[model samples]
Target: MTDSYDRVAVVTGADSGIGKATAVLLAEHGFDVGITYHEDEEGAWETAALVREAGKAAAVRRHDLTDPVRAAHVVDELAGELGGIGVLVNNAGTGSSEPLLGMDYERWRSVLSVDLDGPFLCAQRAARRMATEGRGGRIVNVTSVHEEYPRVGAGPYCAAKGGLKLLSRVLALELAVYGITVNTVAPGEIATPMTGQEDRVPRAGSRPGYPIPRPGDAREVAAVIAFIASPAASYMTGSSVFVDGGMVTMGPQAAGALQSGDWR
Candidate 1:
């Protein structure tokens, strides 16, 4: 059946991938969940149904979080509906793959607005409500390993995630006095709709450069988020935990070793 926590959580981009996983996991952990979707009402309902099946309340809203004002309002409405926001998971972000020199102003700004500004607005609104509630809260950002590393064609995404890393740190420090904790979960390659890999992974033919031999599961990342939102993680704040399966720690030569000629 469904587990139940007294806390309420707001998970943005709950239609698919990591966001959906987080929302369902939070429901299983007993938190009444508020989910936001950009244009996928069907997916949102599916997520809400999962929460209900888990025996918790679920609220779904539509939002395009690039507009900071509207995004903030969305958080406000969700908080009002859910009674109060106890956990805010900033997982609503998009990515673009373009070289710095090839990127136009609009593309860069779009990535930053969604990845960084959206989180700022949502966190601000949620934290305000959380402070008024007189109880502690949790804000977990679903960042990426690219926040610290570099990818060839994803300069804009990397920059935005890097900024998000610092944003989480700053918010954690400023909101600590209010009894709130802020942290980030940087995930590696996970099998999800976003990654275009659903149930099974194709690995028979090549099996190239992965030291772990397979991508991570979305539920695994959700487990980390669930822990951060729980009371057990009260002492942790402003920290970034990499769940990338040693991908980030691998050296330049590591990928080569997996290749036949030691070069990709």
Candidate 2:
């Protein structure tokens, strides 16, 4: 899949939250973007507008990542629409608030399908295209702080992200022969609609357990992802980058390891 679009990037779940910020940031950095969202057409259009505002081409797709075939096809579809793809950001994911014992089997499956299977399929599809293109590519997975440690009431989420972290390393090694770089970006307490705090900036006391004094902004995480997708990160792969404002490094005590929800 090749197109006239230069430096095109594919960002899943770009309708809102960190995905929205990632798409817009990639555009600002001279990448035409193909954004995907599930059940949020309006939000997808809004994100596309941001990409266009940055003087880059934008395309939107409604993606349901539960099916492996469909998950992979979205990347191909978006790459076709955008002309080509140079970077792939697997930012689409879902979490379960129910504890493990209370969580039904369907709920567990839903979380894992979208968070793990979907990204794996998407990465495989995107990697093949990049390798075949012979121009090298960037693959960045947007994981979570749970990837490093357990989160209360979020067993499925933690499992999926932890799996993805390891998957990034495997992809990095497998794709290295093709000059493709794969990495994971783990974020903590980001201000987004997902956290139900889109209207306000992350404050120091918002997440009292965090030592940073403020919740992280979506843009902060996006910036780090953009760097990993850039040529500047050519030498990095099989590594995990934390955008948690020192939350992960602070250990469980200082960061309130027992707390769940947005603080994680």
lDDT per residue, candidate 2, 13-37, as tens digits?
Answer: 9999899999999999999999999
RMSD of 2: 3.5
TM-score per prediction, in order, is 0.91, 0.92
Model 2 alpha-carbon miss at residue 247, Å: 1.5
After superposition on all CA atoms, how large is the RMSD of candidate 1?
3.7
Which runs in model 1 stand beyond 4 Å of their true positions?
1-6, 199-208, 255-264
TM-score of 1: 0.91
Q: Model 1 over residues 109-146: C-alpha lDDT tens digits?
A: 98889999899989999888877776779999999998
Error of 1 at 108 (Å): 0.8
Candidate 1, run of 10 with poorest lDDT: 199-208
